[model samples]
Each structure stands twice: as C-alpha cells, then as structure tokens.
Target chain A: MKLEKGVLLTCDPAVKQILLMLNNRQPFILQDLDEFHVVIKAELEAWVRSQLETELEKNTYNLE
Target chain B: MAMQKGASSSTSVKTAQHSLLPFLQTQSQQSLTRLYQRPSSCLSIFRLLDPLSRQLILNLLWLESPVPLSVMTAWVTTEGTRAFDDAVSILTKLHILPNPSVKLSLSPTFKASMRQAIIGGGTTASFGVPADAENKKPPSPANLDAYALERWETILHYMVSSGRGQRPREPSRGVIKLLTDSGLMSGSEAAPQITSAGFQFLLQTPHEQLWQLLLRYLVMAEERGIDLIEVLSFLFMLSTMEFGWDYSTSSLSPTQEVLMEDLRDYGLVWQRKAKSKRFSPTRLATTLTSSLPSLPTSSSSSTNTAAVASGTGATSEGFIILETNYRVYAYTNNPLQTAVLHLFVNMKSRFPNLVIGMITRDSVRRALANGITADQIISYLAAYAHPQMRKFNPLIPVTVQDQIRLWELERERVKSDSGYLYQDFQSLGDYTTLVDYARQMGILLWESPAKRCFFIREDGHNVMKQFIERRKVSGGG
Candidate 1:
C-alpha cells in the first residue's frame, strides 16, 4: 500500500463509482453474464418470461 | 506512578480534556485493541465520517502523483478551506496520510477502501448481492413496509413489555429473545423490561436505529466470523437500488442471499417466497445508500416543505417539536417511535397525528438508568428535532436541554474516560508546545498549566517524538 512520495492520479467520480462497483463485485463472473450486453440479455429474459406466461394462460383459458 | 502530585502552584485546567469524540475514528476510539473486540465491518472507516467529509477525502485520495495541499484546496475553493484542512488533519491524525508534505493524500488503506468502495470491487465484498429465487410474484411495497415495521416494532414491543409495562398484544417469542440477546432488554423480571440502552435506541433516527441493531448484529455475527464488509456493502447496494426494480438473484453469493433474507425480515427487501431469487428494495433499503434521512412518507406526507422541491432531500426529516416550556410534541404515527419517545417523556395525551409530552428530570433520569448516556439522548433529540426546531442552531431549547445534562451529571458526578496519561515534563515550554499541538490535532485531553503536564486522549509517543525531532532540526525556539 505504499505510494510514491508525491503525485496522485485522479479518477472521475462517475468512473470511480463504476470501479468501486466492479472492485466489490465478485471476482468470478458468470461466463454468460459478464458483459453489459449479457446483463441486457438477461433483462430480456424477464420480458420473455412475462410474455410466455401470458400466452400459456390464454391457451389454458381456451382449453378450459 | 506518573502523577506529578505535589507542585508549588498547580493550576489544573480541563483545557485538554477530550472525551471520545462521539464520532468514531477519532484515534482514541480507533485502536488495534478494539479491532478484534468488534467485527471488521465496524472498521469501515468511512462510517465514522459523515458523507460530506468522506467526499472531501475521496476527491483527494488518488493523486497517483503527489499534489500540493494548495492544488487540492483550489478544487473545493477557499470557502471550504476549513473543511479541507479539517479533512486533511483528520486523515493525518488517523495516520491515513503517510506524510503531510505541502500536499496531502489518503493513507494506502484508505485509498484502497475508497477505490473499491467507489469502484465497487474489494476483497471485502461490503455491498450486498441480490438473492437467487424460484419463479414467484413480486412483493408489494406496502406489504414490505408493513413487514419491516412489524418486525422492528416486535423488537421494540419486547423492550417495552417489562412486567411493569403493558403487553401490546403478543410479540413473537423469537422477537423477545432477539431483544434480550441484543441487550436491549432482559428476562430478569418474569417478563423483560426496556434497558436504558433500549430506551435510548428507541429515540434515535431510523438510520441510527438501523445502525444500532446492525452493530448489535455485527457483534453477534462476529462469533460466526461473518464478514462485516460484505454485510455492509450489501446494505449499501440495497439503498441505491430502485424501489420497484427487480434484481436477478442468480448472480448473488450464498452469503449475500442469506443476508437478503435476514434483511427481508426487517422490510429492507421483499421476495415472493423463500424460494424466490429476486428481491425488491423497500424505502428503508433505498435510504441506506446515504446516511441522510430519506423520509419514507413522501408516499403520503408530500406536502412537507422540505420534501416538496427537494424530492426526498430531507430524507432525514426529524418529526420532533419541543416547545420552550419543555413540552415535547412529535408528529409520528409509528407506534414503536411513540414508545421510544415515551421513554423520556411524561406523556400527556396522544392526538391522531401527534403525541404530546414534556421532558422532566425524572423522565430523563429514568432513561439514563436504563443504560443510555446523556449524549446519546441529546444527539437523538437533536438529530430528529422537528424541521421547525432544526431551523435554530443546535435545535432543542436550552433550558430544557441544561436540565437533561444536569440530570445525567447528577447520576455520574465525574466525567469518565479511558486514555493515556502523560506527566513530568522537563519544562513548561516543552509541555506547552506539545499541549498546543495535541489540541490543534484535536487529541489533547487534560492539562495542568502549573504542573507542566498535559494528556492526550491518544498516545503521543510517535507524534511527540516526531515533534521533538522537528524542533531539534529547526532549532528549538
């Protein structure tokens, strides 16, 4: 944890927060969920589940 | 053994007298001695400093290369010089600053914590992770709020349900045991009664109330070697989360999910069932991100002036109103909150929206007897003193205030503290300079001007020796 006697590099607060998030983040990342793109995809999964549930319910109502 | 008892003329002055700055991390309170005693989570250095101070430190934390203090002060502006200087001095005193050249930087440990805390990745895992769940419907905010308030109140109900007290319905036995274990109450008298600590805990802001409980939990968690940082980080992340947004729990660590469930009991989060993976953060969880109060009442108390334009800016709005006549009125519907106030007030009546009471010596003394300190009582009142009361500096009325202190003082006639004692200086000049320096750094404790001795709440061995060396180098004046 030693530092050079002088000179500190500054990080932007926005970037700093992102870094803090990543730093505290679990070291191991899910291969499929590591990227921001993957997170978006997972979010898409929720929507798909919602839609699928609706379709299945409609079909069940018809069958009844 | 070190006491300089006999002196020709000893003018003993409490000049350097320092009690542990109620604020943690004031060196006196930060020792390796207390480290193992408490869990690592309490060691989150940032908790001891308010957000404002933490921000000021983080801004200066990363000068990858050293920057002069002058350069740093320019960023916050001269108006913030006091804050900047205070922050630097604090960092230095905490030994977070290795050297105070013209410029200052955070200690290595602080830099690491700040970077991780800011960047959100530390080995510590201070932030909470969402829990994995089976497919289930999401819990409603109202239900979550009710759940949290009920569990917390059940804890409080246990506190107030001593044999002498009325039992409000029946709080769960588990809740009663949690209260007893937390030392907020005990089962000494057939039924538990509120301990002094319990009464004081009841009076704190929701944030502090949460902290007291969490700290107690931390102590208990210490036995099991629970990671305090991980627990804290999870709580922090929960506060920043959107109230209604669902987080995927599949990515959460087992420990994190375990914590999420515990938090669920407190209403900090909501899950459809034990098998549900995702949880929704309630107002309480969202407010955890900042120490500032986030009044959960914007759902209804929208007309409050503080919340109108600010939009939850008065997140810490205290609902206390103390009239000059020592009459206290708190506008709150939370029964637990009412019971907390009743601890130190002689309740006159309860209106639909407000509880009227007066602060008397007996009331204050009764609270003190329960193990609450006067400072805890006062600060709780100050922190939640009504918005109108808050407009005035230091808030609460002076006459009513002095009486509370007097009552506590009568309980313990002398101030009690633990710190290093220093004695027998060669000359008054040597002692005077040391005293002044310690005072400047805000660590000086007690001094006898005539006796040539001064004490600091912290040991000055390293600093004092450094001061002597610096004096020799400069040619002692």
Candidate 2:
C-alpha cells in the first residue's frame, strides 16, 4: 500500500545490468523492480537516459 | 513503404480540410448556430464534411419533416454504419444536427441557410456581392495567382530563412504577429526564429499551411473583439468566390473590413489600391475549402513570371533525386526550397538551377534534435522526388528511408513513465487481486507477480487505495 513517485524505466535485461552498474556510481535508481525494469528518480530521467545511451554506445559496433 | 506513403498523404489531405472542424467544435453551440446562419458558411462546412455526411445532408435537405433514425440507419450498408455513426456524431457536435434521438433532422438555421446556398435564392447575399461593372478592370487570373504565390511564399521564405541566419525580407507586421502567436516562430518580431513547429509547417502543402494560419487568425480575431461568426462567414464566402472577379467592398461589415486588410497581407485577396471599392479573391482564397492545390502548378503554368522569377516553378512538381548513398540533388534555385533542404541535408554545392547535398546521420540527428521528425523529412523528400524516381515502386530508396528511421529510433531508446510502484502486498492473493483491479482500470503500467509488486499509473493510485480499503472492510486482505 506504500506509495512513491518516480519514473519507471523498462528495457532489456542486459541494459538493466548496465543501469545497475551506473546506479552504484551516481545513485539515481530508486528501486530495482526486476531484471528488466527499474525505478529511477523522476527528475533524473533525461540524465539517466543519456548515460545509458553513451554506455551502450561503447558496446555497439559502428560502421561510421 | 508505398502503401504507407499513400495512406499518410491521403489522411494529410483530409486533415487539411477538417482542421477547421476541430476549431469549430470547440466554439459554443450558440456561436455555431450563428455561424450556420450564413449560406456561405453552411456550404463551406458542408464541403468540409466527409462524403457520407455530405450525402446525409443532401438527402435531408428537401425533407419537410424529420425522418426516423431507424429509416436513415436502414439506408446504410453494414460496412457503412461506422462512417454513418461518425457522420452523425460530427453533425451533432457541430450543431448541424441538433439531436441524435429517434428523429433525425438538420438544425433549422443550418437547413435554411444550406438550402439557400444550394438552391440559389437568398437576400442575405451570404456569397460575396459582385461589384458594379462600370469601369471594370479586374486583375487577370494569372496575375492573381502570381500575386498570391508571391505573398504566400514571402511568409514561408521568412520562416525558412529565420533559422539559417540569413535575412530575407520580413513579412508584414500582422504576418509576423500571426507567426509568433501561432508558436511557429519565437522571440521578438525583429529577430524571430523559426521553431520546430515552424520547420514542420514548412513541410506541409500550401493548402494545409494556409488553413493553419487562418485558424490561428480566427483566434486572434476573437481576441481583438471581432465577431467570430462574421469572420468565419467571410472566409467561407471567400472560398466560394470566383477567382479574377472583383467583389464589392460595400457589402463588408466594419469587422470584415479590418479582416480584409489582414487577409490581403496573406494574399487571400487583392485590391487595386488600399481604398479600392472592389477586391478580387486570389487562387489561394478561392481554393480554401477544396482539396485542390492552392497555388498553380508551376509546371503547367511556367509562364507565371513571379513563379519563374522566384524560381518557384519547381514547387509542385517532382524535382528531387535521392540516391541510395544518401546523396540528394534538388533541381531548384528557390532560396526557400534550398533552405528547407538545408534542414536535413548537408549541402555540398549550389548551382543556379540545382543544389547537391547528402543526408548524413549527423544532419538527420540535428533535425531530430530540432523536433523535426524522421517521417516529415522522409515524406518531404518523397513528395518532391524526381519524376524518374517516381517510376520505382517505392520512391526515395528503401535503404535511405529505413536508415533515417533507425537514426530516429537511436535517439529514442529508453521508454519511461511516471507512476507508483506497489510492493509488500500482504499475500499472493492480495497482489493478484490488486493487479487484476489495476488491469481492469486500464492504469496498470508494469507488474511483477513473483516479487509481490506492481506499478499503476499515477492517476490510479487513489482509486486503488479506495479499492483496497473496501476489500479490507470486507475481510479479503
């Protein structure tokens, strides 16, 4: 019955693991919902998205 | 891709005409009835309705008594019922059909005015009155078309040049005011910058763009204490007006006179002098309600000096060649067209009659950052693809389209929603019941049954709380 206001982010399980690692450094995650979902601070959604994008970019093979 | 393009382009045209419908629906019922009093407005609105609605109106136009709803319903085929219902609903919303009860009848004012419009007998002169023929020297249709094209293009060119740091001629003060008011541009009038909406506006066909501007003008008119009904009727009258024929200004009300000055700035009407007793509705104004192109096709009328002088001869026809390698070659020297291309293409060179560019990932991303969507850019290229490109089943090379979409998708990786996470439910039964309840309410965002937790939308939290409280009272928790 407890209530909290935050942004729920859904992504692949692999991406969730990356989010967990980033959380340890910056502490934006409010709660880890499951393997594929996490709740982050509402105000930090944009910042977290940018961080995840940059982190994922390193693992992707780019042609250009 | 071809099917998608066809579907989207058709809907865009529908939206261009129906855009006024949404505005009209927002007005008070009284105001709508007042608007329908004018035969011109009634006819214009009839033209705006979908085919089925138009049919329904025509069928009911001559009937003296209201027909039973069942009779009308019986006339529609099984597949047409949805469209029938939609037509009825639109009519009811616009107050053209006052009620949706057992009896179906057109609103009295609407019926009378519409009949007057179609049957051609009304003293109100809802259609514009013809000016006296004495000393008649009306502007030729070609000249009117050129004038409309020039005035309309000035507004567009201003918007395009705003973002590029180039200073094109600023449009009239009223035009600038309308642009800023409509959120197409931002900042002070002297240094207005085109916004994302402005970029999208540039991509619309001139017909849609004019409606967008006119709708905004309607709002501005209301703010200025001008009668909405008068303004609307005047616009509808203009749509029914014949191009190249002068309409007498003697019939205009004071409010309409003011509007005439504003409409002139947009090239909707042309007068010989500021104080001229007669004004001619240009091609732009006459085609306001029809799906026809507002401006003349530059290809068919290459002799249009203003269009040729401004190099807008390529405006309507296919002039772009997009390669699989993402190289773009546009066969136009119009600065406005080139400015629009600069929005999503990296320009390499510009010749008198051609411009070459490439749709690089960076360029597309920059457009995306400015809130110009991938679809808008793709459609613009597709719409203006070279005649040779049109021979292909799907224009604009599928690879180029897919890559542009992927670039857009790359920027939208994460999906986020603001909601409350419910955890620590008393038991599995409690979690299941709450989850089912949230699902029924259509507010469930995400749920994890194994963890005895679920997420519900922010607005549903209070309702869920009340449900749980009621359940506890009944000893279910």
Candidate 3:
C-alpha cells in the first residue's frame, strides 16, 4: 500500500515569502530541505534574522 | 417520541412517524435545523420518502415515549410488514432512535412541536388563508400565463445583465436586496459577477431553482417577524391556485401583502397597481413543486417569458451528445447555464444555439476553488444533458465521469469522517443481530459479516444502544 503524506499548514506568514523561492531551480535556500514547506531559505533566513536582531525584533518574532 | 398507533393507521406510518417525529422535534427547538440536511439544500429526499411513512412519524412524535417496533409492526397488519421494516431501517440509519433496548421514547420537545404541526388547529393560523379580493373577474389561463412569464423573465434578465441594458421596473427594492443577500448574485455589486453557487443555481431545473430562491425569501420573511406557517402554507396553496384566475387581495393579512410584493419579483403573481385588488399567479407560482421535465414545455406557462425562457430555458427536452473523449456538447445559450458549465468545463467554442466544453483538470480545480462541489457539477450536467445524452449506453461515457471524480479526488488528497466502531461483541449471535439491524437501517459504513463486526455513523448511536439492550433482553448469547 502506498500511503500519501500531507502537511496541513494552519498559520505562519514566513512560509508565504519563501514560496517565491520556487522561481529558482538551484542554489535554492529552501528547496533541498525535503520538508513539505519552508519558512525561508538559509540565505533569506540569515539576511532577515541579522537585519532584525534587536530585543524588540525578537519580541516581534514571538508575536508573529 | 412514539404515540400509540391506532388501528386505523398503517404500521409503516406508525413506525416512520414514531421514529422521525422525535428526531425532527428534537432538532426543531435548536433553531429548526433539518437534522443533517444543510440549511440551504431542499428536503426533496425526505419528500421522496413514502408520505405514509412521514405521516406515521409525525403522528407519533408528540407521544411521550418511543413507539415499540413490535407494536408498530402489529399496526401495519400483514401487508405492511416489509414497509414497516424499511421505514425502521431508514430511521435507525438517520440516527433518530435512542438506544435500541427494544423500547423507550422520543425527545420531549420533538414530540410536542411535531404534534402541533401535524394536528393543525392552532390559533397561530400558520397555513395562510388566501386574502379575498374584491375584483371577481376570472381571467383565462392564457392571459395569466403570458403575464407571469413576462414578469419573471424581466427580473431574471435584470440579474443576468446587471444593469448593462435598459433597467426594467421590478416588484420592489426588498426583492432585489434579498437576491443579493442570499449570494444568488449581489444585485447591488457594481458589475455583479455570478458566484459559482449562483451558476449552479442557474443550471437547476426550473422548479427546484424556484423553490431554492423562494425558500430563501421565506426564511428572510420569518426573520422579520412574519409567521412561517402562514407564509409556507400560502406558498403551498399557491401550487394549488388556478393559473389564470384573478383573486381578491382585500382579505390578506399584512404579512401576506408583503409576500405578494416580493412574489412579483420572482414572477409568481402580477398586479396592475401596487395595491391592486386583483392579482393572478403566474406559471412560476403555480408550478412551484412541478416536476422539472414537465414545466418548461407545458404550453400552459410559456407565455411572454418565452424569449428568455425559450433562448435558454427550453420547454422541450434537450439534445446533448457525450463523446468517448469526455467532451460535452449542449444545445443552449442561456447565460445562466453557460456560467454553470464554465464551473467544470474549459469551454473550447460556442455556436449560435450550442455551447461546447471539455471537462478538464484545471477547469474542475478552478470550480472547486470557487466553492462549487464536484457532486453539484455532475448532477447539474446530468440534469440538463441533451435528451440524446441520456440515450448513451451509460448516459455519459463512464471514463469521463470517473475521470471527473478522480480529478476532484486528487485535489483533496486527505479526507476525514467521524464515526463509531463496535468491537468485542460477547457472542457472534448477539453481535450479528445488532450488525444486521444496523445495516438494515442503512447506517452501517463497513461490516465484516464473517467476523461479526461493523462500523456506523454517529447518528446511529441511538439505534446501537437500543440494539444492544434488546440483545440483553432476548438472550442472544
């Protein structure tokens, strides 16, 4: 029997931005993860994390 | 609740009413949800059920206790045993019965209210008394037919065009607002786009669509403090009303007058003046419950509305040819119908009086995205297929229909349903009885006849309990 796997995504906006990554085929930050979905590629993730590394930013991440 | 089945009553009636009344009565108090039937869909399935079965259920629902199947069986005499068995089976499947300990009773509220509806002598006068009009001249049915079709087509055209052409005078602003609010089409929306549901509505056989829209109107009227029984009975009465005769409006209650104005929008009736003493019910009104195939072509109601009625709503049976390739060709140009086809088909071309479309993956997905269901699309296609389509060996190539379903199934890869699983029966004999009873009631989802095991829907909880109790009493082990 072949059982199909599914990921039911409920909430999280970061996945939306990373969806654009499908435009590229390689050097893809999120493509190789094999996860059903990804929040952002490492490059994109690193860029956003470093840019908003303040306590307020951390609090905002928790809020999100 | 089960009332005592009188000798005069048939057992089928007794058993059905005994089970159904309690169920309906129980749900009625909770804002009258029609049990599992959706708030929007019609109860035609229930309508199709044997009327004797319904009456029996209604009659006994007022009783304080459940009607024993034993007693009900006796009431039907020898001839009705099979029907009694079938009715009980259906009721149990619907999950209306309480545990099957062989006997018990209805939910208290269901018994009381259902009895009230069936008995019918309430001062509330829920059934509308036709208002007496002063103008006594009865017009010929021909004149009435023409006026009705004209009035109905004019309004449908308004919705179809959405003010693109000359805006015609209609019944009232309230009627327009009700159409928009029901999501049939937002009449007030600038460039009203036909919602997928609206498209489905357009493809409905003429009679069903009328009931759907009219029911929406009736619900709205009920919310505004108007009596439902009066309006509902009046609507039912309209089915019996003579098509071409003018009746007096003078005797109408305030609520009936309100409905009159609204009915004009749907072309149920026509009035020369706002408070015209004489009004005639159009073909739309008289044929409220008429069968689909009979209505459009029955020259009786095909007067002025023939153009819109003719162009799209053919009075004659249709011509549709379904190819082995899964393409469907329909002989129609009705905007409403074309919009419906667009829901499940990728239209390849259109000729003067014919439209051709292919049922494809992307087209179906787009339809699903818009909230139109796979079942609705299939039924719509089947309902209006050209007469020729019906003559196909299977009425539609099985491959295409199966493909339509497969295409839909691929979209929803995961599905979930809540149900009850029965395990660990004390003995095979005990278990088999309950399983057979459950299956007979139509609630069993899966069963192992060999293993004495089965699964059923949640609604069967009531019947399951009863079955177990009966076994305990009967010494099934």
Candidate 4:
C-alpha cells in the first residue's frame, strides 16, 4: 500500500483487471472483490472511487 | 508445473525441438559472435546454460589464462565430473568456451560482455529506461493481463475455430501473416487452416508457445531489414523489466520503435496510443525470462481471466481428469482450452463448465497425422491433469500412456529423416576421422562401418562441410 512520492502505486494485474472491467458498467458483487487479498481490496476500493469521481467530473464539465 | 512423466520414461520416442534453447544452441558461430556483442543477450544466454556451465563460465571469466582440463575437473565432485564435461562441451559448441582439450577459457567477447551485464556500468541502455512521472494512471495489472489474454486468445481462436463454421474474433493481418510464415497455418487469409505443426504448437506449454511466436517475429523483423542483433537484445531486455510500470520509448532505436509496434499488437505492452511516449510491460513481457513454474499462478489459464478478475478463486492450472478408460473430463469454461482438448480428444459432449471426451486410438492417430505426437498429447494431459490425479506417480493412467505410445509407434514404424549421406571415402582412416569428428560434434545420426558411410542431420551438413574443407587445406599444406 506504500506509494512512492511521485510514482503511482501499481496493483497486481488481477486487481487492475477488476478496475478496468468497471469501465464496462457491469455491476460486480461483493464476493468478487473478496476473492482478492485484503491488501488489494483497499487499493481497488480507492481506485473505484477515483474512477467514479473522474466519470462524475466528465459529466459535469460536459454539461457546463 | 508438473514434471513431464513421459520425458523421464526412456521408452518414449524423441520429441522435436519445441523450445528456444535448442534453437539457440544450434546458431552459427557468426550469429553467436554477433549476438554476444550485446551484454543482455550474453546474460540471457548465460541464464539458459546448465548450472554447472554457469559456474564454470564464472570461474573462467576473470582468469587471464586458460585452466587446464585436469584443474577444471577437480573443481566439481566426482559424480558431477561427467556433467562438468557435458557443460564444457555445450559451452564449446555454443562458442562460449574455447579449446576444451587443452584448457577451458571464456570467449573474450562473452567474458567482457557478461562482465558488463553483472557490474551494471555501461551506456548501452540495453535494459530499458524508466519514464519520468506521468499524470495519467498506469493501466492496472489485471487490465493488462486481460488485454494480453484477449489479444492472444483471439489469435488462438482464429486458428482453432477455422473449420468450426464459427468465426471467433479474428486476429489482425500481421498476426495472421505471422502464423502463415511460422508454418502454423497455410493457404490464403480468406480460408486459412491450421497445419499439423499448428496442432503440435497448440499442445506446447504456454511459455514455450509464447517464445515460438516471438522467435517467429524475430525472423519476420530480420526479413524486413531490421537489425536482428538489436531486436534480439531488446527482446532479452524486455524479459528483465519490472511489470506494471511505464518505460520511455524516446530512447529506443528506430528498429525498436517498429518492433514495439508489433509487440503491442501481440499484447506484450500497453501504450495509450501509437505515439505514446511511455509504454507499460504487461505480465506477458515480464514473464519472458521467468521459469515456467514462476509465471503468475492466475495467468496460467488465459480464458479464466474474466472469472478470476471478478474475484473468483478459480485458477487455470489443473482442471483435467483422465480416467483409466481413456475418458477425459476437462473442467474448462475457456473455449481455447476446449478447442485444444478437442484436437486430440474424441469429445463426446460439452457442458457449460466441463467437456467430456475420450481418448481413442483413432483420435490420437488423427492427432498424430496433424503433427501432434503421442508424447506431446500425453505431456499436455499430464501437465493439466486434475489436482487429485497429480499426486499419483504417473499423472495420467499408466495404461492410457502406454496405449497412446503404442498407437503412435504403429505409424512411426516407417520413419523418415532427411539428411546428407557421406560415403565412398578414399581410405578407411579418412572415413574413421570424419565419423569421429561427426560424433564429437554430436551430429552423427546413423552410420555403417562396413560401408564406411554415415548420415548427418541436414542442419549439421554445414558444420561437416566446413570441417572437410579445413582438413583439405591442412592436408594439402
């Protein structure tokens, strides 16, 4: 979970894969994320929130 | 990875060279000499050598003079002396070591290059350069894994689904041409079909399959006038990069830039766009130099990525069940695995999560016709056999193994080898000398002492020819 000063923290390919699948707008159940280790769960949750914010910002800017 | 049971069984016939090591070992001296110029290539080659060979190479690397044979033999335990000799022969054959009879010494070029790799003081930038901080988020490892799987599976699907009357998404033209050139597929793109070599390819381990394609790409690159040396050095370098991080493409040569495009197409890297300044190595690229067992446990099954990505604990490593009666119950939802299984199995039924198949004499013989050997199929089965079955001494049922070999041997009774026949020497001494030389070189296939003639493999013809020419020059003088 340690992120270097400027470097982005990279997740396991499996974790990145789950986040990328979110782009398809498919709803994943809790059991799905549970399959990953507890450490990656936090990272993935953070990534999902950030993805949500990016999507929300894009919509707001488009409307403006 | 499970040890190949058939490989250990002396009864099985010899399998064709399905690995990169044999191909590397057979390279001409000029190619090896040119290849040794790059430190990364030397390091990669060094890694592939036997452990004894590596230790021997290290001992000789800094030595100013050659270590005599007697001194070299004393370094290893008595039991390892034979393996030591084998290591020396392999090194000499690959031109890594010189003058085995008199003394062992590293090739000057290899010593210097390998030293440079170890000490890490060089401007070659043979290892890729890390990019500066980027604002955009790097693609997640899972996504890259998925992308690689999707892209690679698409190619396999194109090959496997050719005659099924269903077109899975086809791979690009470049990949198709690659397959065609590699002799995996034949005929026009409009109706491409898998050749027997393709079937044999389908049965190889995932790592071996990846290298086969990459090796073909290297050849394709050379054909387009790209410097093969630079391309190879870059490939060896890619195997060493950290996964999931961006590397700057600015420092790459023009040849690497083009090579990068093709690698991207093959799903080894991810770039935001064709002209992106930074690219990330996917799991495929990172696992290049890793041993078979060391590849990500989850990435073993490409088709299961979606399931695994969704946090399902399923892995692709072992899902096959082979019964004593030759019935195969493969627990696979991936079409690619199913297609590969269908190649040799008389697939009786297909379910959502399982495929029921039986290995029959006809089916195996048909596979044999397609260039897939009995040994390859048995090894493939043993490699993917169920976890329960893996605990057994022989992974597959012993009876089934013997039956498959029996089926293959029935057809193999009349075998063919295309090689050069050397005979009709002017003297017995001359014939004996050439035969002895061929044996030393390990290229003599068969010989008849009565007729003073022998056969050497086609590729070994060049070595034999060169030896005779050198002998003629020396004898004339």
Please tell me which predicted candidate would have the highest TM-score against the true structure. Answer: 2
Judging by lDDT against the true structure, name the best candidate: 2
**lDDT over C-alpha atoms for residue B437 of model 3:** 87
Clashes of each: 44, 0, 27, 5
The better-scoring model by DockQ among 1 and 3 is 3
lDDT of 1: 0.56
Assess chain B of each prediction and give its TM-score: 0.57, 0.90, 0.57, 0.76
Q: Write the per-residue lDDT of candidate 1 for residues B277-307, one digit (tens) a residue.
A: 5668776767653544433543424444423
DockQ of each: 0.01, 0.70, 0.03, 0.01
Instruction: Estimate, for each residue in B344-457, the C-alpha lDDT of model 3 and write its tens digit.
Output: 778889987788877776777777766676656665665566766767655556677677677666544322223455655667876777778888988766555554455666
Model 2 residue B123 CA deviation (Å) reads 3.8
TM-score of chain A of 2: 0.90
- Please provide, for model 4 over B314-373, each residue's C-alpha lDDT reduced to its tens digit, 9 standing for 90 to 100: 356788999999899998777888888888888899887889998987678778878888
C-alpha lDDT of candidate 4 relative to the true structure: 0.73
| Ordering by TM-score | 2, 4, 3, 1
lDDT score, candidate 3, position A57? 29
